[model samples]
Target: MNDKINLNYLESYAHSFTEKVCSEYFGTKKYMSGQEIIQLSPSTQVNLMVIKTLFEKWNEELEMLKANPYFDYKDMAVTEALKEFMNVLSRAIKIEKQHFIPLLEVALIDTVLLAIDPLVYFWGEIEKNPSPFHHLKASKKYIKWHEKLFSELISKGDHADEEAYKKTLSEIYHQHENQLSSPHILLQDLNKVLPLDWDQLIPKEEILTETAPIMQEPAQENPVFFEEEETPELPQETAAPAEPVDYRTSDQGEIDAPKPSLGNGKSIDPALAWARFEAEQGGLLKGPIESLEEGIAINQRFMFTKKLFDGNPDLMNHAFKSIDECDSFVEAVELINERYTSRLEWELDSEEVNEFLHLVYRKFDEK
Candidate 1:
């Protein structure tokens, strides 16, 4: 009736539910909801809110019960009291999954308490029996017993109830400080799943890291090189150099100027200018005609030669030992065309090919 929940009173209602009565009504000979579990209408928030508060109240009561030594009813090495409390909760809390989280938190807390109680009991026994051999051995023996189940349970619930699990583990950790300090299984919580019958699967994580993605630096088009067009310009003659070009022809006694003029320079020797000024203007008098025209001509000659070779391949009838010895392109072409082209007759009649060409030319055998 009170807005505040009473955990003890609720548990009593659960304790009073008879198994036969449970079977008769709810048809399960198991945990019974203590008449107070919230089963509010889907549209109502108030009842759900009250149930939420009661869920917290139940958790507090379970913790209080643990603090009192009297409620450790499952004194067995592995206790099922967590299952018992969850049964009470399944009955008392709203059963719908959307409302189940807090009730589940209750079960988680019970497991936390279950794990913690053994350490408390073992140490308490040591205090009462105080002897180096008896107490130390007693502590180690119980710790060994606890470790078997403790590791598995903590690992399963590691992330499930982080804070409470950590607290419970830390208490057990320090209480049995030496034993817990030994090496732990280096399991990397790496999870994978497959169909039930599949025994093994290649972990995507392993394969992804090992393989490198294919590097396709986008196709770089062959950069085009074109010849700059040459323009005729007047020559600026440079003064003759001291090295004395016997500009005279060796056979005909006459002076020869450098055969072709570089044109822009008026002296045989280059002119001098202030380095800074020349550098600032980005180099003086680089006639685009001299630099780009020569390169353009070279590429054009190479491209033309390539086209001539490809367009009319010189086929050979029989191998010729030498080209200068053979003397002409006509001599080469006459020999090979007779062998390769003469072998096949494409007068167009295979059942498949004729059918394909027929479709292409005649639409179909329309009749």
Candidate 2:
């Protein structure tokens, strides 16, 4: 099978490959007035471009992250992105509302599934349990499922051939529909399954005397684990079934690059570089943390925004809810990434980051 599939490629197709489509998709300019700073601003255009650019990058990263077995992305990219985008855009209404309203409605469905699709969350006060892998299905039973439409459109965009898209989508639909009951494919590990008493439990020194080379653990870990380590089973809310493959960073790096992308090999800002790094490394979702040491370092760096996270039980709840909806840390990072990118692009365009922060602090401290 091909290594990496760019949903961004599909994403670009879903929305026309233009800032106008993205702007119209999100209605970013809906609130602009004739005299507003956004009046004829290329910065606004660039901001929208970067936002979509990063979203696609993050989407790819989440896929890579899911290989951790300990990380999940079903909820993050599919469920959470669906939900948060809707929540963020819920207030929108415009002259073209009729046209784009369906996207918003799709967002609502995405949110509902993401929120309730939890490996197990109460729906209408009724607790239910669904396997992430099991629920990875939906298209077969529902003739009009969203995947059919998305797949149809995506294939149509690919222009493979007449009915070629349908034929391909049919296989995908069957795979997802049947993945729940599929036989487990296990390749036994020699070292892990090696009998301890092969030589009647010979001592290491004696074994070394035979000039035996040391065996090591495989780099690939099992894919598809819930973020909650103690969970008795996979979350009831699995999106799509993506197998995780463990490899060294060096090996995985080879899997990360796009077949063809827009980069021109020019020097970019360090911040953009960092944004790209996070967007890619997280792979369509969050990455598997290498060690407690690395995780702690990340947490400490994000500690600067810790205060903004305080005094809000809702926010803590929101984090968990977001994970359940988004399915992984990488998805959360994407939302944060999008917002940060938007904030930067917006601030840069308006030249108002300083002014905006000044106002925000003034009210925050009531000074």
Candidate 3:
């Protein structure tokens, strides 16, 4: 059955379908209405409906936040930012033939793949020795049962009855164990059940690839999958005068402010700071947190600026500098609320916002 299915052909068909949908709906229309979306094929409609529902939920969450009286002015700034974000999403988005074609292909591919081979679609390509019982796990009946079981477990939350959950699982497995068909037979039933339009798109010809038999290796004790050496700690050294680094300067040739101390009225060595900065490149910020007053790390600056401030470096710099001048976290947050949020319209619910604010808290926190 795998030999008869053409993965490439399926992918191409998905792309073609996505292009057709985009051209018909997104070409002339700025935003697709739910009424119009309902007219699309059932498979396409399912994905688009999900997107539409989520967009509605986003608006609801913003409204809920705005109505909460306990939220401070700084937190309320998120509502304004979210409103602007929604405007951009709804109005600015246009179908770019080059970019948008590939975007919708995955959803279409999943729909087609599910109709053809639910086993491979859900479990990925099975490797090594195969079991008939394993294949039965992918059957629609079993999948539905698994979903229901988990849904009940999740609904019960922290107070869930573990024994009841276990019993339910046992009952479900035993109930379906004797009644389930073989994996190959289930696959045939799935193909038969596919919508006529999709069934027509798939080619009848078989294009099989040759595969070599797997040779099992003897098991060994405590096999390590991955290994990494720990980074050596830098030795403590006397603080040197802060010197200008080439990358630390803005395009206008103004050098960044001096690095903050580690709250003990002592500055880190300039060489050590530079070395730590270099090590932190291409990864997340790590400790020992030398100083919150230090300029934002290069990677973090780029990410926060891009995600929150619309990739404007000058705006990010201005916000950071303004925050640095404030004497306390409260003042810093007030500055952000008045000057930045309304003007720049930052997305408040974003993880980047929390991360940026945490750094601000560290700056004014009693060390």
TM-score of each: 0.16, 0.19, 0.28
RMSD of 3: 22.8
Off by over 4 Å in 3: 1-5, 30-39, 48-100, 116-367
- Using lDDT, give the best candidate's number: 3
Off by over 4 Å in 2: 1-3, 17-141, 144-319, 322-367
lDDT of each candidate versus the true structure: 0.26, 0.27, 0.40
Ten contiguous residues with the weakest lDDT in model 1:
242-251
Model 2, 1-367: lDDT tens digits are 1122122222222233233433644465443211231122222222222222223344346447666776555765756764465334322313243443334233222222212111111110111112221112211111112333233323332434323332433344334433221110110121222211212211121221222222221221221111111112221222343321110112222333442221222211333433443444333212344322222211121221223334232453354344334433344335434444344332221212222221222221211
How do these models rank on TM-score, best leading? 3, 2, 1
Give the Cα error of residue 288 in candidate 3, in Å: 40
Judge candidate 3 at residue 93 and give its lDDT: 34
Best by TM-score: 3
Tens digits of lDDT, candidate 3, 158-192: 13233332233334333333333332222232232
- How well does model 3 score by local distance difference test? 0.40
Candidate rank order under lDDT: 3, 2, 1
The better-scoring model by TM-score among 1 and 3 is: 3
